[model samples]
Target: MDTSSIVILDFGSQYTQLIARRIREQNVFSVVLPCTAKIDEIQAQNPLAIILSGGPCSVYDADAPPADPEVLNLGLPVLGICYGLQFITHHLGGKVSPAPRREYGHAEVELIDRANPLFSEIPANIHVWMSHGDEALELPPGFHLTAKTANAVAGIANPERRIWAVQFHPEVHHTKQGSALLRNFLFSIVGAKPDWTPGHFIQSTVTAIRKKVGSGHAICALSGGVDSSVAAVLVNQAIGGQLTCVFVNNGVLRRDEFQKVQRNMRDNLGLNLVAVDASERFLAKLAGVTDPETKRKIIGNEFIAVFDDEAHRIAKQTGGVDWLVQGTLYPDVIESSSVKGPSQTIKSHHNVGGLPETMKLKLIEPLRDLFKDEVRRIGRDLHMPDDILQRQPFPGPGLAVRILGEVTPERVALLQEADDIVVAEIKAAGLYQQIWQSFAVLLPVKSVGVMGDQRTYAYTCAIRAVHSEDGMTADWVPLPYEVLKTISSRIVNEVRGINRVVYDITSKPPGTIEWE
Candidate 1:
């Protein structure tokens, strides 16, 4: 283990990624691996410190995930979290059992050993975020209690062996001084340096990509969103003419998206972009599909088919296209599947899981381990345009998911107009950058409305706006009345075949960001 890196072992906790994110916020590099990772795998990063993430399983469960016991003897500084604390206790000849009063939310932990470097500059009693059912009942040999809450052992340490642990999560904002606690561990205890920056990442990644793709041809599936656009550029920088970017019009994109993206990527970014028009074919496939999942499957399947045809065509021209570059970010990986046994995934990412299983090309995902914010930093450092860098996330199925029912050429055009107006008003009001997603959904149900003294029935338009850190969870944005009025008035007054407008007021738990 070196002094520049940190390795976080995932024990199936959803917060494992958050732990990695928190450490990276300090400009130090950290990587996440499953708890089942071998000792040599952990040593591969030459990490300066190791973090054991909290998980859902009890320490005594039959299927409880296990860390290599050999990891404890590596002589590296170790910090164990909730389930982590229990794991260390169970492994080191200590007792771990169900807590009489399980802590699942906010609690207070009183620091008893104020002189301990782990608690240095922290308050005597601090509020922390807790989520666990088990607790350490007895300290392991050579371990000493450093802090305690009302009902459980809150903190423990063995400075001689350089191991520390806490029962509460220090990566969440609810913990108040959580950032400070993590910083203390990163700098004061582990003696790590702040050397991982945007320039550092780009330089290292380019070199790595170049070496990996030596004298090979690659093609990028560019969606023109922040993720794919950045990924395309990074790959282009690695192997200039050996890369081809394929942008397909799937018949459901936003207004002027095809043209705008082509111009920006080819003219502005200097990418070898190949624009494909398969609108008629995509629209034909989605003619009468209404079920949300069915629509996603059809679109995803059709997209892969089109991309496969394109890859083959390009391969014949360039001798070969051996690699497929995707913008698969960390959250996409987490949401698509389990980090380990204890982590629960909401749904398979349509962007990732929907890919056909028979594709033969190898994948080159440079941004696989990065967060969305970190990708934006790299984009800015690479001198990518603000329009591409600041654009909100667009779904893989495009307007097929936004439109609630059957997709057709006419419906797509109408929805595009309404969606365009909603976006324009949001951007005009200077809320585009502030809002996570603001778009219009065309509904199948229609209502009667008086238009210039003539009664008419038309499709209803629903406006959706949400704010989110990542697409995993979101809250509906409460747009101002004036902005809503402008959007509704414009959609009804200017765009024909639309009578009424509505706003979605539900959050992520009860309702997803998209209506479908």
Candidate 2:
């Protein structure tokens, strides 16, 4: 089925993806293209509307990002965000210059044109989140003012041209009416219908997958994580018995994750799953590897090797396997690279399994266009257990990335124990679902501590918990003092090797979620 898409042109803004996310939340599909996209490229989506994303550049600056002015001449309903507004005004015979006092945070917008469909039924005064330094001093040709702040223009419109633009961001939560404003643009202005649902997605994706993999069998590397697990199930629905799901134990998984994932995939979910205990195999390859990148490579190569062998065996049974299903999400596709900006759209899902080139298998990424939350909705529609859909995000290398130093079996066991305690404590406090990730890291440096009146030098366990809508940005979660105390005391008393437990409070800007 042909879907109505709203095309968003990227102008190098940090909030560009957020604009796409907001539109997708409305059940009207949207696509993002770099600002450098040609006019015909913008036309290729058959866009119902064109959204210009906010960027960090100024129109008058010599180094400002490139844009196709012809995009406005296409006669599509146009909505411009922060930099988008300035870009439109500057290109259409309007004056744009630095504001006397820049608006960088929350501001109040007073709607002047109440009858405009873009502001239909919205309150006259609204609290909006602003981040622009430039202000429109004069109206563009045929454009009239629709809204304004005390210091700057907030909204403008040229109804005959079917274009509207806003100075404040309508995609962020800081603006209380952000969603409502976007809802107005999508429905009242652009006439988009909310037809994108999980059920619709499942039906469409299954049809597409079946059409692509007609006579060829597809094999999935199921990590037991939600992304892979959901991908495996979606593929199974398409190919039935032809899809073989392989779950390999890389030895660095969380405590009992191997058996737990096995139960969920095989006994509970009824997938034709093949479980391989390559724990010993992977641990040996990572034996003394300490550098994070080296450990990651060794683990990834070993996984590819293990999965390849399994694929070869399965191929022999099914005549041949021709596709590899991956649980790649849209965020992975968005942030995978840069095209002279914060991000550029990645054309393909990063090989989820890092399979060898010789395998010559085609890629089937059912969830590549979806966000994590959207994937969960599809999982629910498929009747997948909450345990599988709600599982926290885990790194590709699993606990190897959690452990700061050597990848030894003993350290793995120690971190797993401490990690389990951290999760258990968080869950007991009813914080498991609220927090993004709650895990323990095994630090390489151990400190001296008194245990049972004996001085002991043991490994230090660092407890890390974070809050984020996506893993791309996160803030350290301040688990309650009591909860932290419980996690710390339990790790010290229960885990034999760890004498000290510390909490990580770093956010994503200066530090990543993981220690490595």
Candidate 3:
């Protein structure tokens, strides 16, 4: 065993990654492996404990994913959650049956064994999130029921065998005792220590980069947003003067984004930054290209070409650098996993991916595994400015996505003006921090209206604001009616764009906040 790590086996559950997050919160490192992982691979990882994640499928289903029997026989502490509990019980000669009434929400759990390590410090009856359709009728030999709910057994433990199982989800906030229960299992029952932290991560990455680069230089594509800026700072800290940052202004950014970004790069972070004005090139290429997907593809391709040309120029001038750095995050990696599948072909991601293999430079991505909130925390720890760290997320494709149909210099200017008004009004109302994402969308259709006794016809605008912990799921924020009225009136009167304005009220399941 590595004596420092845990392995979470994913069974295609939405909360599988949450299990790993919870483990990391305890300071113990964790990795998610496919449930069909080989016995040899599991052994090679030498995990201190193995956690099986819940899945959508019932254990009795014909094609349900199963765990390797060799994993159970390795004498390591094992914890099974939700469907995982059913799988363990069924594999060990126990009985499982579909529930007559499936439990799907909050439930009260009572711990029968007060002395049990997993329930020692917790209360007797605690709230837990339960989502399951199957229940275990009986436990395997040597295992005894440790906890129960009003309807069925809630948990089981075999102390001698170092195995435990729970039918409830302990990784969600809806379960008040979830964190405590997981801490007990990871620390008390399995004897794992918490050592994962940003410091450890920074040191490890520095060591890895040193070994990989061996005094070579690298270049960064800084977009002035949180992601690329933070990435540049991290790489600069690691490699010192060997890293150069290149910031491009494609003429589609928000009001004054370019200037503020330059000040940030030069003054605060003290990076060797190159400011390239490619607005003319981008505007030329985007002329008459109205399709959203087409705009994204052209922008992505142009961004690569620009960066490549700059990198080659710098390399030629500075003895030939050997690496490229980017600010790709964990969610970006997860969503882009199926690049060759139908999903990738249909969806348009603003970030640039699929870098050329023909380029001689190797790649360095330090923030690949971090969530957005975690990235913000790292930036704070590094003493980055609050304005840059808390800045709203803007798509790499910029105002192009905000414009529904056509791409033109005039249209870009109009959208930028309207977007500026939205940002300014939201900030004045002190609601910027409360909202996860807020932006203005420009519509191609125009409405007729009169301003100061003059007839005017311009593009319509839509206000989109959403609240989310993670971008994966979100709910539209319900701004005060007065605030909405104020914003709508100001945009129509101040900006010369559109006549009509509307607010998007759709939730994430039915609608994504982004119009494109």
Distance from true location, Cα of 510 in model 3, Å: 1.3
lDDT of 2 at 433: 85
Work out the TM-score per prediction.
0.96, 0.94, 0.93
Reference-based lDDT, each prediction: 0.89, 0.88, 0.83
In Å, residue 180's CA in model 2 sits off its true spot by: 1.8
| lDDT, candidate 1, 156-213, per-residue tens | 9999989999999999999998899999999999999999999988988888889889
True lDDT of residue 289, candidate 2: 82
- Point out where model 1 deviates above 4 Å: 1-4, 334-348, 352-359
Identify the candidate with maximal lDDT: 1
Off by over 4 Å in 3: 1-3, 43-46, 333-346
In model 3, how large is the Cα lDDT of residue 502?
88
lDDT of 2 by residue, 61-180 (tens): 999877878888889899999999999999999999999989998999999998998887789999999999889999799999999999989999998999999999999999888889
Clash pairs of candidate 3? 27-194, 27-195
